[model samples]
Target: MAVSFHVRSSSYPSRQHPQAAHVDEQLTRLRSSETASSSSIRQRLSNLQDLHDSLEKMIRLSVTNHALSQDQIEKVLDGSIKILDLCNVAKDALSQMKEGLMEIQSILRRKRGDISAEVKKYLASRKFLKKSFQKVLKSLKTSQNKNNNDALAVFGEAETVTIALFETLFSFMSGSKACGKWSLVSKMMSQSKVTCETDANEFTRVDMEFQSEKSLQMEDVQNLESCIQDLEDGIGSLSKSLIKYRVSILNI
Candidate 1:
């Protein structure tokens, strides 16, 4: 009654369990999915940090540019104001110079008027003397006497001397008209009024010419005076001859 009961051996592979292998594969897949999701989240956070840094840098640059522009504008405004002030000062100086030129012109005009009056008076005196000389010559020529020819010769010499004196006076007057010193001064004054620059060079040239002409005028006056003296001496000699001739005629 002790029957032999043999235990059956398993036919599956002895090295591996099917249920355990399936569980191992599922565990490996879950770990891989978790690693991928963590890497994606870290990349997104890095991108956000970079964007914030760029925005800060842009704001800083904008603030710096605005400050520099404001400083430049202030400097330009200050320079413009200085230039305007300098212009005003220059304008005032020019106005004063013009006024001084006007005063000089007025003085020159008055002096010229005085000179003209003097010339007129001298001319009138010369005319009167010339008429008197002509009358004396006519009386001597009409008279019939032995000494008449000598008297006429002396009178002719006196007339020649008088003519030379008058010619010198006329030449001086003509020179004054041609030179026109006052006219030059007036032109200089007009030029000064129009510009701010100095006209010293031009004025100096005009002054030199005026001085030279004035010297010539003085010389002419001296020559005229000498001629007049000579003429007077000749007239006196002729008068003496006439008186002697009249005494002779009375004696006859």
Candidate 2:
């Protein structure tokens, strides 16, 4: 009779391999979790970038509106000033004509109607004088009318341009999708900023609420909230600056 000892093959997994297998499983799970978390974070970052882009576009439009308003207002003012100058020029020309006429009358009185040959010669030379006078009169009338028409057109253009800018600003500010006055637009912009901030804060709070309580520390919560607050402040500041720029342009 032979004594037999039973030997088990290591091929059958047992406690010895269980530890290594458990570690591999844990690593796989961790990698999966990290990939999911990274994807979620990437999505959130994309959303934030989109929001930033929208805000920047709004700010750029506001600046454009302000510049257009200022340019139109300046044009209006310059047109008015030019009209004033033209009026003065016309007045001065008329006064000079009157003085020249008076001097001619005085000279005719000295001639006593039976003027000498020298006086006749002077009268013949006066043809050039008469032509110059006619030319001056024609030029003055045409210039004055042209200036007046140009001023009118400029004023009309300014008014149209300003109105367009106002409509654009109002649409952005009010979010009402309707055109309105500047004062109304300003108030709407302020109110809209407040609403956006409140909504952002609410969204952040909700995001926090969705996270597992065990995973989030108080510090993480505070940092996320601070980021929301900063975004709100930045948007509000931009709105205020836009309003101020419009106001200053109107004053000018």
Candidate 3:
């Protein structure tokens, strides 16, 4: 006779283990938080890029219009000041982006003790972007400082030239008795030639400096553009890494 056999199912949960469920819930929250943070960062970066583009256009226009009218100069200066304010805003936004990434990284490390390779990759890209952003900021600051110094030098030189011209005109109008003295006239003519030559040399130097300043500004702009492109690529990579990390966590 064959004996009858009976099997009982285990009391423990199947796929829905409590520990696994907790992990999945945590992963979901992290994904949600990071998604929001990334979106904010992207928006800020876009704003920063737009501001940079506008500032560049302004600089180009101002540089090209060498003979700006007084009103135009005032307008340019005002616009530049406004652009600088916007730059500060962009800088703040960039800082926030960095901080947000760092916070997220820290949280992930604390929770997991060790993050995934994709997360590590994202962090590295973010760090690189931060460095690049700083370089771009420094380049912009240097360009602005140089432009300001060059403007001051040009203004001072123009004032000196104008004063010299007026003084010479006034001397002639006073009808000095020295005008009849050949030695005195010769000395005056010699002094005038020296003054003219000095002024000419100064003017030439100022022109050269202005050209150099323009070239430097152009270089700064180009560097910033390149940096921006790199930063964009880095951001894209970071975003992809974030998505991959989320997917990996879900799979786990």
Candidate 4:
């Protein structure tokens, strides 16, 4: 679900962070980024970083504590926990996929190990991870929070956006759910010239090629390796921002 983090004009006139509107702009861009391609996901992560940076600024103001009750704070904490879990799982998958990619790269480079067997094992591991990620992805719903025009509401909505973004990314990683689930993104896809930088399903392509009469290529392994590195770096940065966010809310 998309959310604007700008403080509402009506809600006790919450203290406004200078970049709150900027955060909303980033949020809009992220919502429109329907494809979880490596480039798009990296862009989304950059937007998330900006949004969270604004959040940290907003957190420092007195209104943050006044707008939130103990119960509401706990709710935010629950969502925060989910965000960390989602982030961690992604990190784990990327790490594993990178390791597997390296193994395949080594096999291609030195003709070490049964290449076909190693390829099969890598594909199988990815398939298993995809199956497991399904459950986690389902929990990241597109929220439609009413009266969500204030910063406190934004805090919760931020969590929703975080979840929804991850849902799209993981969906791409699994290569299962079509973009149609997010109707706006699907609709924009036809008009959008920008798609994934090397689609996450590139691994599936590599696996398919390996299974075919055609032998493995170093180019395939290297391309996927580059994509994974991009994702890993983005996720690591997001993870740090998310942790700081958790700390900010608690201190409030």
Candidate 5:
């Protein structure tokens, strides 16, 4: 019975042992795990590459913004320089205007002084002429009273006095060379005032002392007429002279 239970050795595989089978299965599982780990590493590396590209783009943007800011700063600095140049030009123009105003003020002051001096001189000359004429007439009257041939001598003296008074009055009045020249007695009559008779009547009414026969005659009437004509001419000349002088000053 023991001999019938014995196994045949030729039916079993030579390399196939129970321990060896378990080792093969373990090695296959380990290979599959290593392949899965390699796939996970490749995924991590791809994510890192994306992050690096984003960082590079951000850096480029920062550089561009910085360049634009620098350009804006340069433009502001250039504008400031131009503004400063304009300010300097305006300052120069203001200074020149100030100087011009000062010069104009100086000229006005000088002209005012000159006008004041001319006016003073003109007034003094008029005052002297009035005083001198009064004194001359008083002295002639005193001389006539002392003479023995009083009436005849007074007539000659009066005529001489009238002529001298005419020359003095004309010179004081007329501004031009017209004062130096005179016409003869006959020529003067033609140019005389047409109201001579009215003037004589007026003179006679005013001067009561000259109404006496001893003092007034045909010659005295002629002399009086001549004196009246001379006085009228003098007044006209003085008016024209004053007006002309004023006009000349305004022109200057």
Candidate 6:
């Protein structure tokens, strides 16, 4: 995504325009989901899907062209595509996690030898996925100083919050906060119990249990399998809305 461009003064930052106000209202609702849980993220994505539907209406109206410049449209389009890619990565992570979780469950069913090896494998994949998210996030952040995620394009109010939401979504998915070299996911796995109330997302629960359990419990694996399935469904919904929104942008 492109960095922050020169702020076009005519672009209304007050969000007085009805579409802008509507977007703000929807974003406010999404923001209310303060927890970093899978359910919270899913709610935000679903809400954003509705918000994009409104954006689609805006795109079809003649006023949308007046609201955003040709350059701003291109910027939002570029950033939107990147957000789509980010969503795809999240979906892939969920799929892989689901696959790994099923493998462990199979072993549990068979009453096989050391489940630790399988647990280790799952954790390794988590670490790898975390790093993948970080690499993409770093690329997104480079644009933030000038235009992206945190400080998205100034003439791009319609998409500013939209981009920010995707940033938040991915950040939570990756458990991106760091303790030295380790991500929050890695840090949580090292500890025995889930002491932190806010860090009690589905993935974290799974990680903590895998580390603390003497023998990997079938119940926890089952719970994580459900979590993966839920996330996959959420990503599918979000991706659908995003593609429609992208098409709307093109039509304008």
Give the whole-model CA lDDT for all candidates, comma-separated.
0.30, 0.32, 0.32, 0.69, 0.30, 0.62
Stretches > 4 Å off in candidate 1: 1-114, 127-216
Q: Give the TM-score of candidate 6.
A: 0.73
Alpha carbon lDDT at 213, candidate 5 = 19
Model 6 ranges with Cα > 4 A deviation: 1-21, 142-171, 174-197
Clashes of each: 0, 0, 0, 1, 0, 4
Q: 105 in model 4: Cα distance from truth in Å? A: 1.2
Scored against the true structure, residue 27 in model 6 reaches a CA lDDT of 51
lDDT of 2 by residue, 161-226 (tens): 222222322122212222222222233223232111112232233233333333323344344434
Global Cα lDDT for candidate 5: 0.30
Clashing pairs in 4: 1-142
Give residue 204's lDDT in candidate 5 (0 to 100): 35
Task: List TM-score per model, in order.
Answer: 0.25, 0.22, 0.23, 0.81, 0.19, 0.73
Q: What digit string (tens of lDDT, one per residue) describes model 4 on residues 183-214?
A: 43333323344344333365556666766838
If ranked by TM-score, best first, what sequence of candidates would result? Answer: 4, 6, 1, 3, 2, 5
Better of 3 and 4 by TM-score: 4
For model 2, the local distance difference test gives 0.32
With candidate 2 superimposed using the best TM-score fit, by how many Å does residue 120's alpha carbon deviate from the native?
Answer: 11
Error of 6 at 165 (Å): 4.0
What is the per-residue lDDT of model 6 for residues 5-58, given as tens digits with 9 covering 90 to 100?
123347645224465456557655643434455666667667867877776665
* Higher-lDDT candidate of 1 and 4: 4
Model 5: per-residue Cα lDDT at residue 123: 38
